[model samples]
Target: MTAPQTAEQPVYDPSDPSVMANPFPIYAKLREDDPVHWSPSLKSWIITRYTDVRDLLLSDHLSVNRLATFYQSLPPADAVLLKDIVHYLNLWLAFRDPPDHTRVRRILRHAFTASAIEHMRPNITEITDLLLDRLESGGRNEVDLIREFALQLPAFVIMDLLDVPRDMLDDFKEWSDDMAVFIGGARNSGDKYERAERGCRKMSSYFAQLIKERTENPKPGFLMDLISARDEGDKLSEDELIATCILVLFAGHETTTNLIGNATLLLLRHPDQLAKLKSDPALIDSAIEEVLRFDGPTNALVRVAAEDHDLHGRQIREGERVFVMVNSANRDPRIFKDPDRFDITRQQNRHLTFGQGIHLCLGAKLAREEGRIAVERLFARFQNLALDPSEPPEWLDAMVPRGTRHLPVLLNG
Candidate 1:
């Protein structure tokens, strides 16, 4: 493949539509030409090698405290506008380091243990069936799968997990999307930040009230567990509790939605692989892993240098942002043979789609099962699941947590 040719920066820009659609070629070029090159466009060092990406993911000096980076660069006006949202996001486990991260993760780990995930399986299957049943009832040969199924399935399931009322799903979804604009690490206009601040206020208030009510009424579910959960003599602070609630609601569905959407699109694009999986249903788990490696949800994991360091023979100053191109690393030639190829049965498919080390995604298990079950039920319900020729899939103009804006597909009744 030809290398990306641009005068502005040799490295590919994440905003480019072509790059967003298919980044492997650019990633391959970067991996070959400048494995640790600094990019003017991204204003950070781009790490493309799989080993470096993996190592940095587990690096102690490189912190995941991105909110600090975000705060340092915040304009006075945007700071005022985004303070509430930023404040809450600062409390997210993803943005924390060391003892703080340990505290929150330990408390919440109870709610996401193996037994918890196992218990959630039947409900997830039931939800998938119910969604497909609804689609069939709609009587449309062509449907926007992202909107009709992929997006809603996770939202519904997460709400159920949180014991949120069914009627509030729409409101929660709106709030969730607004918060994502800020969380996805995508550069947006001032208006977007305003919307996110509003979302932050509304969501925080909503969850705070919910937590308060649960304290008195004592509901049964994940949120209730979090409300009452304790670790030694320490318990979740009110801010931490509210932040955790928002984190679970937002992170829970958003990543899964992208996973389902990206995986379905990849499968539709590669019918042979889809057919292979159909013939051997047991391959669904491995197929999901390949989907993650091929085009996983998150575009990049942002970190900052904790101290002055030399990486790959280049000097990286302390506090400089490093964009770990996960999408690129998954396709690095050194790690996976035929790295660019989409093979479902690829063995030792150790992908960093869910990240690595201390900050591994809390909802990884739930997200994986949701994707597996969603794919199985989706294809099982329709003999012919092909992309809609009437419209092309519109990819979201997002940087992190990449996914399609809309995916229309044709299916048999």
Candidate 2:
């Protein structure tokens, strides 16, 4: 009888294409051999297992307040600039812990109800339709879907949601892009960090101005809602309101943009699944779910251990950062049978794409709806949607919400 051979362990490198393009093999090995291994490269513990990841996310012992510690670790001069950046991040709902997270979430939920998202479907559909039409008007047989369609759809939707003036659309996108690059920890050179700080300062000032104007004129939007919303007779502070706006504006569209682009490219690569989707357009929802599980927009989230603890036979100390590999947990063989293969019709597909626990994405439902509409409308409009032979897909170096930089596709009738 031949003995079973073990898979070689891979060094952790979040930006490596080998890891980004296909992290399952590495994740599988880690899950089996070292589920709670610490990575010196990341300076954090990497948790990669369906059960462990889910449990840690739900555990109150860990915290999302690790950013402050990170900022403090920077050089003195950089810390000054990072202080201004972290100021806004500190107020973000995603970066808060305990009582603050509980309070802000309660207030924020009032604005993002399912009914509100459903009501916006008509507007979302209108935006998607218009963007698709714009794609064709350029008089080109090939188009970069990432730039021409996927990117604009979510930005416009967010603009509409926030009642942002149409004139400010370009500025908003620039700011959001900067935020994503900075937050995703991609291309983190000194110049890049400076650019992120400039973006943070500009957005902070812009939102502050908007809040001041809205205070007197009043408006119908998420910003306005946050302005007026009260929790136990406590309304959001001016700084809090500005921070929340920045958080939602960036989080709202960035993930969806990646989701649409990633899902479309996935479908283009897997013709069998694409044929299935085209054959039964109703499967768009399930197909979107599958793409999310297969190659989710987000790869991991960092949480800090609150105290010393033992997990899966490994000891973790207080204040140490833990990187929960959501992308890995979704593909755990224990949970999903034949997890490597893409099957849109897979039943009971419980993936951690939107994450779980109290911090689950508030925009999950809306993002899913947008992905569904984008896929359905694109396939319906173009009979032939294949990757452009001239330009291959360029995956972004981002680790958090990984996706293509541009996806040029041959769009033929």
Candidate 3:
């Protein structure tokens, strides 16, 4: 079967409400009928199959640094307006390739090692308990889990990791939310460019100050580590340092927030799985992995073709954008047996939630630890946790990140 070239065929639009709510069915159709699809509207080839997505992620034929091309393609006036945003975004480690990426990854690896993440287990537990304390004391059974719990937990965790004060979380969230609108490809957001530019400027300025303070009076955490991180005398430039801090603050919490939110909601919907997990808390690790594979936070990963090449019969021209649908790939039956089933005990899971290869998520371990701690604590605290029947959970309408906008649930303790 193949996607027919007919006017009646529905085009893949990430911003579409129905698709954002539950894209799996559409993903299944595209995977079976058109594994490599070209979206006329998006002007990007969407890769859905697991093998193709993984290979592309690990392939040297693609480039993660597409901001320059984007800026060049923009109108002069628009480009001028977005120069600051592009400058900082260009400096992000995630957007760099080759030697630069290699150097930075080496220096940064020390901070995110398995032992380092495990050491923070106690701190993670403390943060989780603190947040749960607040949630339980709210004097109401109904609450928006995304805002009250899921969002705040990772924000606090990252904030603590950076030695940022708790009072600054609201400001950080505001700036991160604005930037997410632009970076997440929120199609309907008006003035997204301006908002993102403002956010970029404010966040950059804040990080610059923090970096200056940390330089003069170094703290004992990840931020301090990044400040002194040097690989063969190759240290991060001032701009690179600031950009990395912003990246950590933004990317660190946002995806984990989605992970916790998605996992909790999924469990609530699947009482049998929830019961199983509750009965055997040892499955928390496997359950977290399953959540990552089942309905992970990341929706798509974008890359640009480094050179013209044919992929699965489709000619990918240089500079063209490619949307590697990780969500689609995770559900690919070829890689996962009965991929649609929400089985927490599945052992052969090899989902690309954190991506693959050298560009794999730097904070994957932290995110996993955070998710495990958060979900375990939440379920343990509220035995009768469930979705509020009156209000259905709303998913975020963005192309890059998948998460709940609001998860109203009954914490029937």
Candidate 4:
């Protein structure tokens, strides 16, 4: 991990929606202008250099538990959301760092293996087909790519993985949407809290019943497997299990939903690449990698300094917050061939979309499957697909991730 120096002033202010709206340019400027800077808003230094972000990610001196730092960075009101919701429950692995992260992660690790996801391939294929059936049934109408394909696939796949019945699919989606409010676009303060609170209560109750039932009469499923697995003698606590389930279901749905939507929009934006993919099909994997490289769903992650140390020369005080911009690193010219353009055939492509180190996204395999299959099916179904060129995409730039809220596309059979 290459360390970098910085001044007391912030490199950039990400809280501004305008900056968040199109941060690539700003990120590019930051990497060139001031790779390391302190933000008055965040009160934390920003690290934008591709090498620096990579170094900090793998460095033992930094911990992913940036809860305290994140709270301070937020406006007083926004602090409530971070402290109350994102921090309190400690549901997911992304929030944890080091030994515990390794411990808790080991239990659920087996379930996310390639073979485990392989068992789900047939089901994912079926769900993808069923969704497209609904869209095509409508025929020639203005289709919202986000709702129809992006949101629908992940919701069902995650529900099915957790052995959520075929019946409560709608309920699952509603719960996911509510939970996503804090992170996704158009988050209403009242509505976000209301929805998240309601979701937390409902999901906790529902999973409690499931956990109890599995305890009494265990089945052969993800929920059952997770419950059964124990390290030495210690097992994941009830809250941990519930929180873990919530993380898997919610995180699984959230990022992949945006991946499909963003990929679709970007592909049409580059018609030649789409045509190349449509013609060759072999390029889809590389294309998928590039889509994430170009504009992955997740913007950045929060980390805290675990020790007072020097990064590239500047002193990083212990407990200070750091926002590691993964998206910015993906576009760094030092790592990538052409940092900006969307080139499907670009060979030496390795983007940090799933993040890095011990905290790399767990469900990346499943997400990639959904993205690959969704694009394949979509291009196959619609011969000539293009943006409703006139109508602009409704962009959703929220606190959590980035993607269009609604992308209306004209699909021709």
Candidate 5:
């Protein structure tokens, strides 16, 4: 049963610009008043409390296969137009339930092993330095960190990992941006489906060709590994291979880009903490964790109920959509002391930015390494780094992914 609305209760609307800007206040309100409230605006049950969101993510009753539910909810015409989008999304490991999820995850685990990520550390640093070198050579004191450094570092690192040519960077960004609108659940983007479909077509076609070429002449890289990865004599089908490549290409850089950007902005906003990090460079890891808890790239994760479940006197029926509000839970007063404060040295931090349980982000280690190295080198390179006074940071008007659209900063501050 849905909770009754009260005048004091703030409505949960992601489309609202204010909400998009800073949803924590409304998230706090929802967490206090109705933790498991059904929102008519989004037509999905919004789970706010830390425990509720955590348990649901770790629960078997909730499935990550929500794309089909979304397709069904759309008008027939729109659904038909997004058929290819659904097809590719369905093949993604993120959208599958075990034993499909279990098998693919096993294969991927071998590829993203700690040693593999650690081996890339040097390359990550090289890419970071290369980007900073370019920035320094540009002779521009003012730069959009999001565009110039943060976004490029991860994209290049992932490209190098996959052995993708450097020339495809711009195309990948364009395609990734288009798909983000749909995948990230941009509430206000009316043409999201069309844009995403176009991205999907181009991306899938490109990967299909790449996979064929790689299969013909084997290479020693991540893409080649995906091409030949197997689990207990089982391997990914052709379609699955293409889908996994796209997932790796997209998810590989998007969140980490946001992490770098968000971490930079947060540190700039809290100079005390920024100075603390500068003094103790080892605090980079803890600082990254703090940034995720404070304002992580992923705001929420969508899941669909596989069976009826009751929580806090609210019934979530089967097939109904549920959004586990990660940003809200990270700030739950019950969970963290002074949750709002940006503290790098904080201990026992367990933010759900990478999610939990079976669906925990596969590239977590890679992202952490990328963010730590990127931020560490960035600050090390520009000791006087500061936000540009003329242009302020702008947050992406997105619901699922929390990131700044532009983080203008004075490089030589």
Candidate 6:
């Protein structure tokens, strides 16, 4: 990597919330100064270029193992839980690497196959239409897209996939939100902590009941599929079953919701691209890809160096934690043209929103499906949709997640 003549600031903290809000400029400078500048803040080198990021992912030295995360820190179980929570923020696939990753991922393989997604098309469309009905009834009065549509929308689809009762969807949403807080260390010490604890307990109990019921009498949902799936006396243990179910429920709803919200906000911001898409609905597929590229819900992945290794000529001892700024890598000018612009028709976009390598997201197909349908149904319902003139979508500022809390918008009825 060529080191450009960029001045390195004396202090740049990756952990700082303000920096997390927009880390690109700092990333640009870091990539110039060898895309692997060790941050005093994190005490780890940040990899900012696309090639280096991909290279390190495939490198034998960098380990995405749970033990790797707590190499210098927590107890094994606690470390495992922490790493699980870290990936759980993106619903936990982010924690596994190689063998262990390959093992658990198998249980979910058939769950999200292309054919599986096709089987799901009916329910997905139903959910979209149901939401569109509510929006149409909402009348000319401005509606908060996040609250009225995007936020609640994914929860329904996820509930359907999990065969979870509709009444519990609201609770699941709260739990996932609380989990996000815990992951970022942004939770309030009291109410937030209590909420997260309760959420965990409730989720376990809920899935436990479903597991029991599914065992007694199988059904046609994914939960039932898991209950029936057997491989050489290898079935998901009780805890593993609960954990995996929680993982799916939280993942299926939250991240896709954020993706839809992000894409909608981007479209509103870039009227030309929005107009182009509306003029040609066929662009919806690529538009979702562009949205995943322009600003993914996840900004980085926490990786631990598995063994002592050299990164950019600097010795990184085993167990050292490194945060791969995948978000920054996706925007490298070397890989993307005007990388920051919102171009709906952008071809050759291979973004890291779903991540890469062995730990890549399983729900990615489901997410893109949800995104395309939501936007398609949304556009179909609202003809002259524009930003709610008075209030554009304001981003929810948090360290781990990037999305809008409420997207207020107007529609020509």
Q: Estimate each model's TM-score.
A: 0.95, 0.95, 0.97, 0.88, 0.97, 0.87
Worst 10 residues of 3 by lDDT: 1-10
lDDT of each: 0.86, 0.83, 0.89, 0.78, 0.89, 0.72
Tell me the deviation in Å of residue 241 in model 1.
Answer: 0.9
Between candidates 5 and 6, name the one with more favorable lDDT.
5
What is the overall TM-score of model 1 with all chains considered together? 0.95
lDDT of 1 by residue, 4-55 (tens): 4356435667778888777778888888877877876767878888999999
Candidate 2 lDDT, 199-250, residue by residue in tens: 8888889989988998999978666777888767877888988898888778
TM-score of 4: 0.88
Model 6 TM: 0.87
Q: Please write out the lDDT profile of model 5 over residues 1-413, one tens digit for every residue.
A: 45666777678988777777888999998999888878888888999888988999898989989888778789988998899979999988889989889988988776777888888999999999999999999999999998899889989998888778878999999998989998888877889989999999999999889889999999898888887887787888889888988898899889998999999989988999999998999899899999999989899999999999899888888998899999999999999999989999999898999999999999999999999999999999899999899987888887788898899999899
Better of 2 and 6 by lDDT: 2
lDDT by residue for model 4 over 1-413, one digit each (tens)? Answer: 32343563334766566676677888888777777766665567777788888888888888877655655667867665445356434656877876778888887775666888888889888999998888889866678888778887988898888877867867877777777775443333566766776776677778878888888997897778788877676678887888788888888888888899889988988888888898899898988899988988877766788998886566778888777788888899998977899988888788887888888888999999889998888888877777887677876646457777788988771
Residues 133-217, model 3: lDDT tens digits: 9988889999999999999999998898888898998999999998999888887898898889889999999989999999999
**How displaced is residue 407 in candidate 6, in Å?**
2.4
Note the residue pairs that clash in candidate 4. 1-55, 3-312, 4-311, 4-312, 9-38, 10-38, 10-39
| Model 5, position 396: C-alpha lDDT score | 88
lDDT against true structure, model 2: 0.83
Which of the two, 2 or 3, has more lDDT?
3
lDDT computed for candidate 5: 0.89
Q: Residue 165 of model 4: what lDDT?
A: 82
Candidate 2 segments whose C-alpha is farther than 4 A from its true place: 1-8
Preferred candidate (lDDT higher): 1 or 6:
1
